[model samples]
Target chain A: MAGERVQPATLSRSEAALVASEGKAPRTERGRKTLRAILDAAAIEFGEKGFHEGSISGITRRAGVALGSFYTYFDSKDAVFRALVRDMSDQVRDHVAPAIRAAPDQIAAERAGLSEFIAFVRGHKEIYRIIDEAEFVDPESFRLHYATTADRIAARLKAGAARGEIRADISDVHAWAIMGMNVFLGLRYGVWQDDVSPEAVADSIAEMLARGIGTK
Target chain B: MAGERVQPATLSRSEAALVASEGKAPRTERGRKTLRAILDAAAIEFGEKGFHEGSISGITRRAGVALGSFYTYFDSKDAVFRALVRDMSDQVRDHVAPAIRAAPDQIAAERAGLSEFIAFVRGHKEIYRIIDEAEFVDPESFRLHYATTADRIAARLKAGAARGEIRADISDVHAWAIMGMNVFLGLRYGVWQDDVSPEAVADSIAEMLARGIGTK
Candidate 1:
């Protein structure tokens, strides 16, 4: 999946800083790879043990990097956890963006986005734990995660409206309604159980979005 | 709200047992009142300090009840926390039941439920904290809270479908999707900020439910 996407030719100065701790970005490709590895490991560690119980050493060990190498990218356990939240958020966005963009219409785009989201959640079940845990461990990131995602949804919705693909009265409320539906559906069908396929879930929601539950 | 609703003629044996710790249920009206006070205090204490930092003494002091009174209702901090989760779950149901029952149709009932829910959240802002903390402090209660709530929603949606008030295809997915929408809407519009009124939020959703965002 990662291979299918376009890779950056070179990291911008800020992008490099983002890969490192305390505003230090990786200067080389190898450095970026190490940063990515540490984050993946942190996801597993934090997702399993939670924030207080998860440690820098555990992440480094899982990443197969030395303790010194861990600090080279992150200042502390908190920094790494913060970075991981953002990384996961970006991962979801990147993973779902293409499917959404490729959809013929807004409703199809939403259906595609939800299908991809559930698929992502099934593969990375820990994403729910880590993101949910953020509410207690890091409140700011928790707020940012939802707020940013909701904003993105709202933007897509408005764009859809402008193109006459959907109703013109689209607002933040619709965005939030759609987002909440997706989040809980992901929790129920993705994290909790897998009896239903993602395609079916998305299809049901898309049908509802196209029509509605009203009898009239 | 409680006054407007029908009260139980008298607490049944099992109902009495529910108000007290373990097998103890308050036998007298005074005992029931005391139990209510303790639970209310626990909400405040747990809401402010969270489960770990919250203490029995804090709850007692807030309730203005003796230490023995606290012991009479709950054996430990954990017990009270668990009870509080159930209590709040019941509280939300009781508070919203009247409005929902009064609505003209299924769609109107949902709108009313969401409106009343946001209003309730605004007044009892601590609800979000307490219930959310239950996710970590007592996983069982946390799951029960959502599961029970979702079940109630599913039942209501099914009832609406039976009455031909909603589409015949109403299923658990629709129920979960509606519940998710209400929850996040409550979190954003209810708890986070009150810039928008609950009525407006409900109005927007009700409109979407009646038609949907599709241009067709």
Candidate 2:
């Protein structure tokens, strides 16, 4: 998941938000903070109220920034929402990258990635609503989120195969399968309820991937 | 998914539609046919036009039924949409049940289910749009759709494990992982495009579930 993780290497919050924003990137530390604040606020706004009911004023107020400062980073509500989606997408990739990179094998890396992703969802419960809403709010962003995620997963699977860590015949099918598993698993265990620990869910799935569910 | 497939057994289209509709099931054969026509038209109306843009009158127009006939089955637009979601959910399960029941083992059953589901989606691309829009139009129906699907999957998995076809440690985690895999795989191979055959996608996933993705 890490080797093919979307976005450039070593991206900051400001940089990620900038990817979705139409405006120029902030120059100073304070400017970066404001942009970060706005993105986070947008996540909460859209997450709680959804895209249509969610307002730009609500985001600015939540960020504790003036409306003008909001405009400085994002041109309009749509711009900020798009930027927020990109920001959240990068946040997940970044959040799970280290654990994935540290894993001993491709299978272990995926386990680490899924475990980390679920844990991330538990903390940012709004992620599902935000990304799901983008399907109707910003169709392109929605596709880009899944498309890039799958691309990264496919990249790592290819790399894993190259290293003889996984099966040699990896393709988009497997990547999408894993991606969907992570998304829905996160929704069920992380957001909907936490009755099951992230490690438990990941461990079960990891076992399936390692030896499969079929009788030996 | 057959052994534990939700809804009553041997459900007709009218019965399936009745599960969602607040009104009573059509009493006569002619009434049932009218109800079926309304539901089919709703699919086309909501599928092509979406829930909000979709109108009750539009549905009646498409079905070639009178407005009174539409009101006879559903009270409001919301009712029809909710009914549509349930109908679609039942449709998918029923569509795939025969192949699943015929499979020799759990893995084969899942493969058969996915293969059939993709084939189903290819013909009913509007499924994603309608079911997804349910999240906003009717949150309960949206939750019910997925929750029930996952439950049915969990049931089949448990039975599969009992028969020594799959791993004994099957739980919600495994069920969700498989359900998620099928959903996304269907979206990619079924709705997004058909360059890859449903059988090929199912075969690849079946191989993964059978032998695992990690190098032996």
Candidate 3:
């Protein structure tokens, strides 16, 4: 049974005990949970107060973990934020990737991917703030991540163009442009709580992007 | 005569000495000059360190004025940044207005206005950054300004749609999208130091906008 998918009796006994203990006690399983708690706490603190002002002790206290436990996972506040951004990026990509891959055409892919990304941002506003606040923390990491993503998307666009799926003249810069606009708009509309429908905004973006600003 | 353009000989004689000997300087003239100095200093500081980290003391020191003097022109750091953003918006409007007004049609108007705006942003990267960075500094000011400008452009696009100057299906949201995308592109390529040619970026944006993303 242990060799198969069956849970070990000892592991289940520990899990039940840990679940029962909750905030009154801390076990090894609970300690691992504390790591995620710290990240969540840090995300909120960093998003609200910004990077320079956010403190590790504040995050640790919020997470109900000891200050020393924070150091076990992250060396510094910046380290915590970097890991947070990487994690958020992965989460976002996971949320949108299938939608992006499922589109029948390049245009459809962008539209569908953008819509999914918007929903992902709405679902994870704190993580989105962490990603944005990280910009002032480390511009290089922010720029590098953005550029790499843009390049990936641009490569896809280029492939589409080669196959006559998209406009041949579409440059990598426009791909970056599209990416930046999406990022900026999401930050403004979703996280910052601007008074605009995310779907309406995305539809506007997709339509204009599909047709362009030109009169012809 | 008091009504004459030329100053009285006696007044002219003292004015030169007044500029040099009046340690406090002339109030109106000196204040105007100091305001300009403070704005220039604020721009440099905000550009270098971004908004939140930038301080009035730092701006005053950069302007070579007393710290108290900084408060006389601007009520707060927020005030200064708001003024800075307003100033940039004014400069952008001035730079692009004539080209847009003179164009024979929507396409020509967009081409000329957009290109001029891009060239201006390329030449004055700091101003562009200050305006863009306003999103992080004061989302309210940023959105108000963007919406105001966007609405004006949107109105024109709506008029065009009504007149059949553009496709009837195009919405005012698309106008905002166009405005947003051009700015996004220019900032990313020209200001953010993304490795791309401004001309190529402009051309691609123009082409994509002119044509739809549809597989024609």
Candidate 4:
């Protein structure tokens, strides 16, 4: 299976096996579209019922695809779940990229990215269930998700430092701190309830980041 | 079962039914000690084998008590697991409270709390697995664990603002953000690896909190 794998765009090496392909781009646009539908359905099935209760037939049912079509893209339920974890990670990155890129400074970029993330989570409430479940179903994928996310944040902070918009001593610790803050805030303000404004939450965080909480 | 329940010292109303016993505290000191042993052992058992594979027998064996004794405190495996989640939450709060109290200011208090949390996690590595697994095993317990933890953090932040040690605008958003930061930092530095100094990690976060990450 590993030998026959062809990496999809944005598919990390660790995620390659879960998204099984025959080492070539033989999948037509329709086939790719079908695979996308299957994943989307799996997210709902797993999200609502959880892994133990969720089934492959249910995924296909939700996708409006035949049972055989699931096997075309995934070897089993586990494979699809693994694939979904990576896809969600990529989806989050892709969804928030434009906002982060458009912001004028590092702090603004983080603020926009967080606002966009909360907005995304509100629409895709299943995201927390799916990603949190990865901890038990696939530990490596769970670790990589946060590791990659913190790395991305760290890289951005480094760039911000180079531009002199942030302190010179930024480290991986700061990256993890910011990432953790964003994640829990999203859970509390986005998925759990919707009354708090995302912009307001992000604005508060942005202010905190711009100036320490210590009284002047 | 609900009618006969008695709440433990720190058991939230949501977690009251899990640590089952008669509506009275009739057990002797030794019995109470035995119950404590069972919970600590259950932590190891569930932490290692997880909920499905972890057994009541394994918990008894680790606790060095007989199987019949297990039933004296808990109604069943599910009961013990739920009880353990609350215990862990209480344990974290108790462990960090002294450090937080001794700090000279809010920023130092936060740094101390994060450092203490990372240290606690290093020794009780199973904490992450248990609290996280509660999301699947017992959703309410999982929710209350985080909800209560965040509530405590928010209360502290609010108190800090009153003391003029922190900004007047601190809110639940900042509390969740800080809680999330400490949790992830504990996972990364405490459980995942031991090379990074917990004090150093907490120090950087303290610096960031004391004076926003923005350049002067």
User: Over 4 Å off in model 4, which ranges?
Assistant: A1-18, A21-26, A212-216, B1-26, B213-216
For model 3, state the Cα shift of residue A36 in Å: 3.8
- Indicate the residue-level lDDT of B24 in model 4: 23
**B105-161: candidate 4 lDDT, tens digit per residue:** 888888999998998888788999999999999999999999999999889888887
lDDT of 2 by residue, B1-216 (tens): 111223323346558456535545677767777876777788888888877789999999998999988888788899888877888898999889999999988888989999999988887888888888888889898889889999999999888878877677778888889889999998889888899999999999998887652222
**Collision pairs in model 1:** A16-A25, A21-A73
Q: Name the TM-score of candidate 3.
A: 0.76
Ranking by TM-score: 1, 2, 4, 3
What is the C-alpha interface RMSD of model 1?
2.6
If both were scored by DockQ, which would come out higher, candidate 1 or candidate 2? 2
Q: What is the per-residue lDDT of model 4 for residues A50-144, given as tens digits with 9 covering 90 to 100? A: 88899999999998999988887787888889878888898889889999999989889989999999988887878899899999999998999
C-alpha positional error of residue B3 in candidate 1 after TM-score superposition, expressed in Å:
19
Error of 3 at A200 (Å): 5.1
Candidate closer to the true structure by TM-score (higher is better), 2 or 4: 2
Q: lDDT at B39 for candidate 4?
A: 81
Runs of candidate 1 exceeding 4 Å displacement: A1-16, A212-216, B1-16, B212-216
Residue-wise lDDT of candidate 3 within B1-216, one digit each (tens)?
A: 011212111112333223222243335665666766676677788877789788988899988999877766666888788777765676577678898789765555666666777777766777765776776787776877777777777676666556556666665556555676677677676667647665656666656655642222
